[model samples]
Target: MSSIKNILYFQAGLGVLANMFLLLFYIFIILGHRTKPTDLISCQLTFVHIIMVLTGGDILFTDLFELLNIENDFRCKTIFYISRVMRGLSICTTCLLSVFQAVTISPSTSLLAKFKQKLKKYKVYVFLCIWSFNLSFSTNRIFYVGGFTNVSETNHMRVTKSCSLLPMNYIIRGLIFTISTSRDVFLVGVMLTTSAYMVITMFRYQRQCKYLYSISHLREPPEKRATQTILLLVSFFVIMYWLDFIISFTSDMLWMYDPVILTFQKFMMYAYPTITPLVQITSDNRIIIMLKNLKANHHQGLF
Candidate 1:
């Protein structure tokens, strides 16, 4: 149990640090003159991941609230609500990233090309809608989550050491579940569709390359590399999301949280957010260049 707690702490800490760096890098790029449309989407994704990690029922919020001696109802509700909102935002942002990248890499003659110019202009409105939807979608959580008060209570579903999901009316629960599941399914479907489209686009691009250049001489183009990165991210996220969903579903059905199972679930829940920023940072050439410049500047300053 201690070991699992340690792992959770490590996951949250590492995720927070990596995401913070990625967020700063994106901010720098967006503020610069050479920003791409995809950069804004990626930046929002990084920011969402950071909040997900912090509000995650891991080391940060739990420990801070414990130290500050906050009230149980407020602490649990605030943490759980914010975490859910971030989780929703994470998926929404990822799906948007996949779709935007697909549209971005589409050839001028492709159908997606028609929306390319309008995407940049409407990106802010899209983000606003995503945020508003998630914020309201997760409001039910605030009413149903609170500090675990009774060990014998069969009605509560334990989510964290300090927080548990309290029972609500069956109709209400069913309604919330339906709405939540629908949202997740829709976003995931979009992500998979866009990913498949991107894969097809890449294959065609590669075929074109094969016609023009020797196989041995072929190197991935910048667009191809970026598409590959987003594909990898989408694939990883889907796996993690489904795993977390299964665990949540099972626990809710059983009305009990096994220590081992809960620990694994938490790990799965944190895995994507923790891994996302690292993947983005390593794949992005701009971030790589920035890191190298920072290192060179540090050495020069030392002299």
Candidate 2:
């Protein structure tokens, strides 16, 4: 257990570091070249990563400070409430990224193209709405999450591993379950649909160009290339998301009873958050351009 906990903490620290670096990179880009609507979404996404990785189970760093016992209802409520808020925010942000990219890549002749033209100017408003909805949606958790302080015969207050939760009345419990399921289903569906649309658009563009230019090789534009990279990252997120869901769904029936599976599940859940920054930086055209220029300058100096 000590070994597992140690590893978790270590990975969490690394994830936090990665998120910080990505956040800085996003800031650099936001202030520099990539000021499009898509970049705005990217910046928002980066902020989500920084906040969630710092505070969420993705780092497990916060676990060290989780000393709430049965008597600390306020502590329990606030901690879990914050966690839920951040997690939900991350989900919304990622879905927004997918939608933004899809809109950005739509052809000028397409119906959605008008919105794409205006999206850049109004992206801040969209971001504000996203933040508002997620924060409001998550406020209910404050009432649902509770911790207990066990006062023993020795008059010692001890913290238990599991805190008490709200009474699962049919209406409240059903709504929570339905809401969580709907959120996941809706977000993932949008991401997948948009990503597929992007892929198809690329195929069609290449096909048309091939016939028009009699060219065997079709080069992807930087926009398409970057969007594809983002799609790949979204694919990675999707995979990890489902794995975590499956493990969580079966945890009590299977995984939770086994330390190995539980540890693996925890790692799986955190893997995307930990690796996401690296993926983003590598996928970012601005970062890639800067690296290429640096290498060229180094080579020229040598000559």
Cα lDDT of all candidates, in order? Answer: 0.87, 0.70
**What are the clashing pairs of model 1?**
none
Model 2 pairs whose backbones collide: 69-148, 69-149, 70-148, 70-149, 71-148, 71-149
Error of 1 at 104 (Å): 0.4
Q: Can you give the TM-score per candidate against the true fold?
A: 0.95, 0.81
The per-residue C-alpha lDDT of model 2 at residue 7 equals 79
TM-score (C-alpha, index-matched) for candidate 1: 0.95
User: Mind giving the per-residue lDDT tens digits that candidate 2 earns over 1-303?
Assistant: 788778777776777787777677767877877565666676666677666655554234335455333235655566566666777777778888888888888899987788875777777787888788888988876675555544332322221233345444668766876788798889999999988998988788888788777565556577877787779878998898888777656642231224476568667656777787777777777778888999999999999
Error of 1 at 35 (Å): 1.2
